[model samples]
Target: MSEPARDDASRGYRDHPRSKPGPGSITRRLRRHRPHYLTAAAVAFALVVAGVSAGVQSGAPVDSAAAAATPSGTAAASPLTAVPASPAPAASGAGRAASPKATPPPATAAAPKAGKVPAAVAPAAAHKPAKVPAAAARKPAAVPAAAAVAAPAISPELDGQIGAIIAANSAYALGVSLIDLSDGVVHGYGVQGNFVAASTAKILAASAYYHLVETGRASLAAPMGGTTAGDQIRQMVQQSNNNSWALILSAVGYWGIAAYAASIGITYDCTVNLLTPEEMARTLELLYAGRLLSARHTAQLLSYMQNTNFETLIPPAVPPGIEVFHKYGLLYGNLHDASILVKGSRAFVFVVYTRGLSESDMGPRTRIIQKLTRTVTGALF
Candidate 1:
């Protein structure tokens, strides 16, 4: 027949004993189970082939160093992205390859640490912003030079004269803010204290109008209080008319004045129109500096002030020929005068505020102001 049924010893098949089932009887059983064994063998062969394929895939070589360099699969990758528990043998070997090429720049830059090359490098290093310790370190050398400049000195004799004058007038509280525009020497005894603004508030109203006019927010030809802006300003400043001041204040509003005062660092009392003598002087300074108004508008305002009706104090005391641009305030017992006095080419801002003295005796108060004015003028001029 077909070379009796063969059995391989290597696989899980074995020969049966002759008594239990002789080769012939086993042969018949084998024939009956042959198909089933074939099916089982086919399944086992397929499983063995799949296992070999899986082993081949899992055992493939891995480039650990390249993986470390680009864990996210990007071309340009960071080696510092992660650290392993132990150094990878491959990466350590790769890092050694880069060390020689990467080490020179920092080494040369760090030569100062050795203390031998410091003097040569310190000058160049001092100019570098990267090594600067703080923001203040980067300031220009000229800044401190400019800040170290000493302010011009005020004389002791001038101080004594002003002190003596104030000491002599013990009846009234006097505040003065005087500054020589030529040299920027500020000499004042009680310049910081506040006094009633009175008609001086009209100056601010006029200034506000001019400020608005210059900014194109308002026009000089515009009808304010049924009258033109020019007429109102002249009436308010020259005549010190309350009605013109009321109209200007209504047009500019109280907060407008407060804004102007704050811009110049002057403390303002919105309720009573109270301000400091220094503030008044500074306002005049701004006018003189061409900061608050155009030269044309400033000249216009100064003209009004020069011709102001109240002239009992500064004008009478100043040299007759010298032009005095001034504004005066009188409220209850308080008398205030602020002027930008021009003698020839020289000019100065002088402000005086007097309170706690009765205005009932007009002659004495006026004479006292004139005396104080003359004393200051003589000392300063």
Candidate 2:
């Protein structure tokens, strides 16, 4: 009807090609006629099963499974030994609380050096059993004057300013103290060498207490002795409150403050809180010149001190813009102590302390301090 359909002829040629394995056109006939082919398929399946069984029986360990089955073990560790004997609690942070008796590694073990005792340590040979007599002991060779190693702790000019500052500031006792924040120089007046802090001692307390607060070891808002009046001790001692200080002393006992001071690294002296005008100056100098811990901490502390009650001290004596954060100690002019914490383009300590006999004595005292503070502040700050 259509020339025998050319497309159908082509399809038939490809499907029934003489050498091709075409899809079954007669499946029923193939099933009945190709029984030998079905038997060959069964034999091939049996060989595959045998190969699989052989592989399973092999003892070779498989990495993934073996690792999962193994157990984990650990090496022994130990603690540190001996208390640290370093200055300033080892600023390097290398020394922390270690085992009390555990020996350290060989590389870390260090032996103490020989003592530098003076030759005079021999103690007069025990009076020589009076081998000669008491005073006749040959005067012990005059005991050779100790070789005084004059550590230049202060300069001559600074020494005079220190005295002038102390003499003028009736608030201070045992003279005054001046430290050059620009450089590590220190000078003291009055009892030039001996230290005295007085109410100014609160500065150290403030320092230690603040440090503890900053480190999270202690809380500021925490009550010292409950919410009662006794709680003032913390606020007063650390905060320089007469009433609070008395409360704290009573609660902790007389020795409590001393013990606490020692623990915190501030060597407190009962006499005037070891506030020699000189030492006060040195303390401030160390604080502002970035010589103290981290620059940030020193700056942070200087900023905090802006609230100090002391005013007539360095803050007023120096030019405007120069900040003075410090505490003022007084007793109807009988005792005047000023501990200034100053900061600005420079920093320094200027403590002018005195044991004024009369309230009027403060007139000259203020003058001396103002001049000294001005001199130092002008040069450094």
Cα-based TM-score, every candidate = 0.58, 0.45
Tens digit of per-residue lDDT, candidate 2, span 1-381: 124446866566555557664578578668786988888999999999997787688853344443344433111111111112221211111111111211111221111111211111111221122144667555654432232212222344444554444445434544555543333334444554444355666555454544555566555566655565323533553356776555434444445556656653345554355544545555454344333324344444444455554466555777766545556666554344444433322334566665655667777666665676676666544
Which runs of model 1 end up more than 4 angstroms from their true locations?
A: 1-154
Who wins the TM-score comparison?
A: 1
Model 1, position 351: C-alpha lDDT score: 80
C-alpha positional error of residue 139 in candidate 1 after TM-score superposition, expressed in Å: 44
What lDDT tens digits, residue by residue, belong to model 1 across residues 124-206? Answer: 22112234466756776554233433332224555556656666776777777666554443456643567787787677779
Tell me the deviation in Å of residue 94 in model 1: 81
Output the lDDT of residue 271, model 2.
Answer: 37
lDDT of each: 0.64, 0.46
